[model samples]
Target: MKKLLFTSLLLVSSTEAFAKDITVTLEVPSMDCATCPITVEKALERVKGVKEVDVTFENKLAVVIFDDEVTSPDALTKATENAGFPSRIKS
Candidate 1:
């Protein structure tokens, strides 16, 4: 019984250590036209750990899903800036 309890506790802790997916919405004021969204999406996708990118041209927003362990929000913002579309976290 003690062995089984220990195994379960280890499993739970191990799972918690694993990376988690996080979604961040960024506002890109520079997204002025239809083509701008495409560029922003491509930029975000290039970042490491980025799992998905959805850019809404009409709303000038980019929603990115990425692994927290491999990347961060700063990296996401830098990627967009490098692509000529500076962005910030949506309030």
Candidate 2:
């Protein structure tokens, strides 16, 4: 029983170890209107594993927090692009 419990704990920890939260800033130069930020925000929020999304029309920047184990920065960019606002990783 002790060995089984230990193995279960190890497996749980190992799975959780792969889940990493990452925050990235994307520059969306095409957001030119007041409603653009809203659109961008909604698009990013639809991506799986995206924890949070903040888009600013004034600066044309989208800040996104997501789980690396489930998604990636490339997927984030693609989401915005599909929403009609192409974006790139902020340098």
Candidate 3:
């Protein structure tokens, strides 16, 4: 019984550690036109581990959900930057 309990706890802990997801909003002030949002979304999607991307052109904000274990907020920002739309985390 003790062995089974220990194994179960280890499995649960490892699963939790491996499945971390993070969401962040970034302010993109450089988007000049309506089509910029599509460009921004494609850039972010190319980044590894990026699960979802939503860009609001009027608000000039990007909301992204990614796997924390595979990517960071910095990487997300860099992706946008590489696409010619530099951004920063929204306060």
Candidate 4:
């Protein structure tokens, strides 16, 4: 029973790790002020599966790691818009 439980746990963790981390650079045209990135970062943090998020205020970019099963880039973009920083995926 212990072996079976350990195997199950290992499989689950491996599956979670297999989920690819996608990074997106966003064109935040509305980020005209210094505080915009802070708000955007905070808003993105509210999303369900974002493992990490880094915003570049000067370059207008955000690199994010998220679980594909739990969220998507389109959803992230929408969240950015709702946060008052309208953004579009780069490439």
Candidate 3, poorest ten consecutive residues by summed lDDT = 14-23
State the TM-score for model 1: 0.82
Which residue runs of candidate 4 sit more than 4 Å off their true CA positions?
6-10
lDDT of 1 by residue, 1-91 (tens): 9999999999999987897999999999998888999889999999989999999998899999999999999999999999999999998
- lDDT per residue as tens, model 4, 1-91: 9999999999999997878777666777787777788998988878888989898778878777887878898989999999888888888
lDDT (Cα atoms) of all candidates against the true structure = 0.94, 0.95, 0.96, 0.85
The C-alpha stretches of model 2 lying farther than 4 A from their native spots are none
Q: Per-candidate TM vs. native?
A: 0.82, 0.91, 0.83, 0.82
All-Cα superposition RMSD per candidate: 3.5, 1.2, 2.9, 2.0
Model 1 stretches astray by more than 4 angstroms: 1-17
Best of the candidates, TM-score: 2
True-structure RMSD for candidate 3:
2.9
- What lDDT is reached at residue 21 by model 4? 72
Instruction: Tell me which residue pairs clash in candidate 1.
Output: none
Task: Compare candidates 2 and 3 on TM-score and give the better one.
Answer: 2
Ranked by lDDT, top first:
3, 2, 1, 4
Error of 2 at 32 (Å): 0.8
Candidate 4 vs. true structure, TM-score = 0.82
